[model samples]
Target: MTKQRSDEPEVKPFKGPAGGWGSVRSLADILPREHLGPEAYRELARQNKPDGFMCVSCAWPKPADHHPAEFCEEGAKATAWELTRLRTTPEFFAEHTLAELRGWKDYDLEQHGRLTHPMRYDPGTDKYVAVSWDEAFDEIGRELKRLDPKSVVFYSSGRTSLEASYMYGLMARMFGNQNLPDSSNMCHESTSVGLKAALGVPVGTTQLKDFKETDAIFFFGQNVGSNAPRMLHDLRDCRKRGVEIVTFNPLKERGLERFTDPQNPVEMATLKETAISTQYHQLRAGSDIAAIIGICKFLIDWDDLAKADDDLPVLDHDFIAQHTKGFDEFAAAIRKTEWADIERETGLAREELEASARIYAKAKAVMAIYGMGITQHVKGVESVRMIVNLLLLRGNVGKPGAGPTPVRGHSNVQGQRTVGITEKTELVPVEKLEAQYGFKAPREKGLDTVETCRGVIDGSVRAVVGLGGNFLRAVPETGAMEEAWPRLDVSVQIATKLNRNHLFAGRVTYLLPCLGRIEQDVQASGPQAVSTEDSTSCIHGSRGKAKPASPYLLSEPAIVAGIAKRILDDNPKVDWDGWVADYSTIRDAIEDTYPAIFKDYNKRLFTPGGVWKGNKASERIWETPSKRAEFLTPGEISATGFKDADGRYRLITLRSNDQFNTTIYGYHDRFRGIKGTRDVLLMHETDIAAAGLAEGQIVALESDAGDGVQRRRDGMIVTPYDIPRGCLGAYYPEANVLIPVEHHAEKSHVPAAKSVPVRIRP
Candidate 1:
C-alpha cells in the first residue's frame, strides 16, 4: 500500500440530511474553480425548461410545474464543468505527453476543461496533435473499412440526445454491424430485461406524478441523495403528506434519513429538515431477493389469516384473477419459503420482516423505487422480478400511484434504447429495420459491455467508436480494460472534455470534440433542439442557450453524419446529410421506425412538459405473448455464499456526494463527512476491529471471484462507517478493479458491482 500523505482529507460523521446550506456552500466554492460567474446561475435556471437545454446529469424527471431552479448540485457542477472558461487546446496537449497525463487523477484530467479541437495520437511524439475534422473522419472511415464490420464496436453513452442516437444506431446498421453497445448495458440493463419479462414492458409503469399520490413508497437498494438529489424533493413532499417511505439498503444514506429542501427558504433558514423513510431496514448486500421473498411470504400468510377470520382479504384477488397469470404457482412458492431462512439471509428478525409486510399490506397504493444497487448484482434480474412480484401481489400496476420504477442513473439513457441503440434482436428487430432503411441489418445480437471487453481481449474486436462517455474508467476490471483497450487498431472518442479514456490510445486514436448539452447546436437548416426522454418516459426538447465552448466543436449529429457519409458512401438509400441538416428529419425517421410509440414525434415533442410515450403495463394493456402481466417465480436465495472465509466481507461500489457517474467535481463528500481524497474503504466499526485494522489504516482488498484469476486493489484506507456487518463500501472505478469482469448478472449481463466478495489485507 502507498503511504498516506500528511495532507489527506479529514473524515468525520455527517449529522444532517443530504441538501441544505452545505449544498449552497459547495456550489459557491465550485463556481470559481470552473471559472463560472454569476451568469452560470441564470444558465442553470434554463435547464430542464421547455426552451432550455436538458441537464446531462441524473435521469430524474422534471417537475410539471417547472421551478425557477430545477437543477441539483450535481447538475450545476456538470453544467459548470462543461461550460468552464478553461480549454484543453491543441497547445495544451503539445505541452503534456500521454504518459504524463496518465499519471494525473481522473478529477484533475477533466478539470483541465473542455477539449477545443480535433486531435490524433502521434506515436512518434507520444502526444495528441491537432487535425482537421474531415481528416480525422476520413482516417476513421478508412480504418473502419479495412476491418470486418463485426470486428468494430460502436458504443453510445446516455448523455446523447434521441436524434443523435437514432442517427448513430442507423449508421451502425447501414454499415452492416450489429455490435452496438451503450452505457445502459453497464447500468440499467437489468431493469429492461427484468421488467419486460414480468410486465410485458421494459420501462417503469408510473410517472413522476405518481410519487405525490403514492400511499407508500419502498426504496430498495438506492441512495437517492447522491445519485438523484431531485428525488429528495418528492420524498420530502411525500413525508409532509403523511405518506410512508420504507427503505431497504445495506448502508444508511442521509437522504433516506432526512432532507431539507434547498428550494424551501423557511426550512433552509431554520435548518429544519423533513424526515424521510418511516421504516428503514438495513439489509445485507445482494440479499434483496431474500428480503423481498420474505415480505411476500408474510403478505400471503397475513392474507390467508384475514380470509379465515371472514375479514377483508389482504391480496387483490380480483385484479389477480382479471389481469395476471401464474399467481397460484408464485404464491405456492412464496408459501414454501421458510421464515428462518429469510431471517438468516436478510440479516433481519422475522418480526421486523412481518412489520414491514404489514405496512405494505395496509397501503392502498405503493411505488417500489430502486437503482443500481438492486440491478448490479449476480441475481440482479431476478431481484428486479421479485420487486415486480411484490407490486403485482397488491395490484399496484396500472394504478395511479403504484408500480415498479427503476431510477435510472443517466439522463436520456432510456431514451437512447428507445431510439434503436440496443443489442437485442427482439428489441430492435433486424427484419423491420432492414425493411424500413433498405439495408441488411444483422439478425444476430451484438456484444454487451462485458462481452465487448472479452472481445477486445480475444482480438476479435479491432476498433471502438464511442459516442460519449469514459468507457474504460466506467466499466469493471479497469486494470484489465486499460491494457486491452490500447491494443485495438483504432479508437475514437466523441466527447466535450478530457477523461481517462483519452489517455488509453490505440494504434490509431482520434479525439473529436463535440458540442455539450448546454451549448447551442446550429445545423445546416437552422438552430436545432434535440429531444431526450426522462425517467418517466416523457420526451422533452433540449435547446442550448449558452454559446459553444469552441467553434471547432461539432454537434453529435453532425459528427455521426460525417462518419456515416464517409463509411457508407455507396449506400444511396441512407440520407445522412439530410438527417444532419435538421434534427426533425431524424425524429421523423424514428417515428417511421417505431411508429407504435413515437407517433407524432415532431409535433408532440414540442408540447409543454413534453409528450408521454405511455407504458403498456401502466395502462393495464399488457403486450406480452400471454396478453397479461406474468408472475415470475425466482429461485432460492443463498445469502451465505458471498464469504470465502470468516473474515471476508462483501464490497459494494458507490458514488460520492461530490461526484456524478465517472466525473468527480471535488474531493469532498459532504454527506458522508469525507474530504480531500477518494482512496478510502467504508467499513463497520466491528468489522474494522475484527479484521485487526484501525481507522485510517491503509489496506489492500483482494476479491474471491473464484475464477482462478487474482483481482486485487491496494492503497485503500479503512474508515469506520454505518454499513452493515460483513459488508464494506468504497468509491467506484477505484474499487471496480476488484470486481471480476466475468462475474455479472445472469440474464441482463450487467456487471455485479454492488456485491463483490473480498478479503481485507494489510
Candidate 2:
C-alpha cells in the first residue's frame, strides 16, 4: 500500500455503538497487511491475561478474571504493529538520507518497521550510518560530560516499563541533573496538581472492583471508543446492572451513547448494542469547568432547599463535616455563581444541568471520570478541582463505588511518575538517594515540556535523550520546534521504530534500537521480567516470549545502564552492570528507594493479577497539610473562551481512532466516520453555515495568541460534525502547530491543546 492523504474530506455518519462487526472487520484487514501469523494470534490471546505481557496501548486496567480474547481493537493493532516481520535495518537507513526522510509523512516513516541496530547521524552525507552499541553509549557519555548536567533533558514516553524508567531517572539524578521530563507533561499533569490539593494523592483512588459496584459515573471530555475501547466491557456490565453513565463533551461521541460487546456472541449474532450513557451533554469547548460548576450549583442549591424544609437532605453532611474542609466557602461560591453564566458559557440550559444533578442526587455513589478534555486547558487544574468538589458534595471520595479517575493515555505513565521520573526535584528525595546509592542528588529545578521547548529555542537545553517518544511532533507549535530542534548539541533516541522526531537530527544524534515489550530480553543472569503500573495503580509483571527483532537490540534498562557506566565511572556504589544483567536487582533497588510503596516488590508483582500499590487517598489517610481533603476553588472562574470571540472558534485537538499519541496506525477513523485522512476540522453544521462556509471547504486555521508569532495550519478540510455551536475539533499533532507552548494550564503547565482560540480562513 502507498502512503497517501485524501484530496477531499470524506464524511459519513457512523450510526451504531463502537466495537461490533466494525472492529472485527478492522482486525481482519490489519492482521494480513501487517504480515502477522498464527503466532501473533496466539500472543494476542495471551495479551492482558495472567502471566502475559500487558497491552502497550491505553492504561485502562485489565479485569481480574481474564479471558482468551481479553484485548481491544487498538491493543491487537499495537501488538501486530510491534510483532511485524518487517525490519528497518542499517541498509534501509543507508539508502535514505536524513534530508529525504524529513519530507516523508509520519505514517510513512513509521510503516518502515522496527529499528534493528544502533545508528548515528552522519553530518557529512546527511544520512544515518550503523554504529556499535559501545560507540553509541560512549559518544552519549562524552557529550553529556561536555555540558552542564542540568542542561541535558531526559524524556520518557508512556511505553517505558517500570524497571527501565526507574533506572533512567536514577542515572539522571546520580549525574546531578533533575531535568527528568516524561509523557505526563503532555497529558494528565493537571490531575496531579488538582488531586494533590483535593485528595492528597495525584493518582486515582478507585480499583477495578469499584466499577462493578458504582451506581453512576460522570464522564467529562473523554471519547471512550477511540481512547480506551476495552473499557466498554465494564460499561456494558454496569449498564446491565442499571448504573447511570453521564457524559459531557464538546462532540456527540458514539461510544458514550451505546457500545456493543464484541466478545458477546449473542449480542453480535443479533447485532444488538447495549445502551451506555443515560445522559450525554454536548458542552462548549474548554467549558468543562463551567459545565461541572453548573452541576455543583444545582446540587448545592437543592441541598439548601432540603435542609430548609427539614426533609431528607441531599448533602452528605456527616461525611463533609468529618472528612472534608472549606465546604462553606466552596458552597458559597457555587451558590453565588448565577445559572445564566453557566448556561451561557457551557452552551447548555439550566434545565439540562439540573436534570443531570437529579440523577447524581438519586445515586448512592458516582465515579467522576475524565480525560485530556478536562486537563488540557488554561484552567485544567481548576476544572479537575471542580470535579473533586462535585464528588465531595456527595461523599464520593474514599468510598467503594466512587472517586476521581483520570483516563490516562499511556501504559505505565503513572508508574513512570511513581518511580522517580519527574521534573519536580522534590519528588527525587535527595537524602533517600544519598543513603541508598551514596550519591549527592541534585535538587535543582528543571524544565518541563513547555520549558524544554523554550530551552531548545533559546539554546539553554544542550542535549535531549528520549526513551521511546517523538518529542518534536508531540509538542505544541510543531512548526517552531521543527525549525529550532536541530540547534541542539546532541540527541539520543532509544526507540523500537522510526518517527518524524528522529528526523530533526541535532548537531550530533544517535538512534539506538531497543527491545520492544513483546520481545524476549535475556541477560547473562537469566530472563528479565519488567513491570508496569496500570491506571488503577496495580503493578503487573510482563515477560516477553517471542524472539527479538534483532540480536543487536538491547533492553531499555541495558541501554540506560550502558550510558550510566560511562558517565558515572567513579560511582562504584551504584551497580549499573549488575542491575542490567539481573532485572530483579533493579526491582530490589526500586524497593530500597520506595520501600513503603514497593514493599515485597518481586514476590507481590509476579502474582496472578499483580499486586495493589495501595492508594493513600482510598485508605482515608490524608497526607495533606490540612490533614483532610481540602476543597480548593479558584478565586475567579472565567467564562470567556467557552464562547466564540471575534469570530475565533475554540479549537480542541483530539486523536483519530487509528492513532495513538503521535503514532499513526492508519488513515481511517472509523468511529468518527472519517476515512483516508487526519488533516481535517470537525465543527457544528450551524457554525459552518454561520461562517458562510460549506461542509468541505479547504481552509487555514490560525491561533491568535497576540504574541506576533505566526502559528498557522493550512490545507485543513472543514468537516462539519455533531460538536457544539461555537467549538471546532481537529486531529492532534497536526493541530499542535496552532497551539503556543506558553499557552498551558496555569498550575500544571500541561499544553492547552484541548482549548486553543483559532479562526478558520479560506
Best-matching candidate per TM-score? 2
Model 2 misplaced stretches (Cα beyond 4 Å): 1-5, 638-644
Alpha-carbon deviation at 323 in model 1, angstroms: 1.8
lDDT string for model 1 (143-213, tens) is 99998988899999999999999889888888877788888999889999999988999989888889778
lDDT of 2 by residue, 179-215 (tens): 8888999999999888988888998898888998899
Model 1 C-alpha RMSD to native: 2.2
RMSD of each: 2.2, 1.4
- Evaluated at residue 682, the lDDT of candidate 2 is 88
The best candidate by lDDT is: 1
Candidate 2: lDDT over CA atoms? 0.86
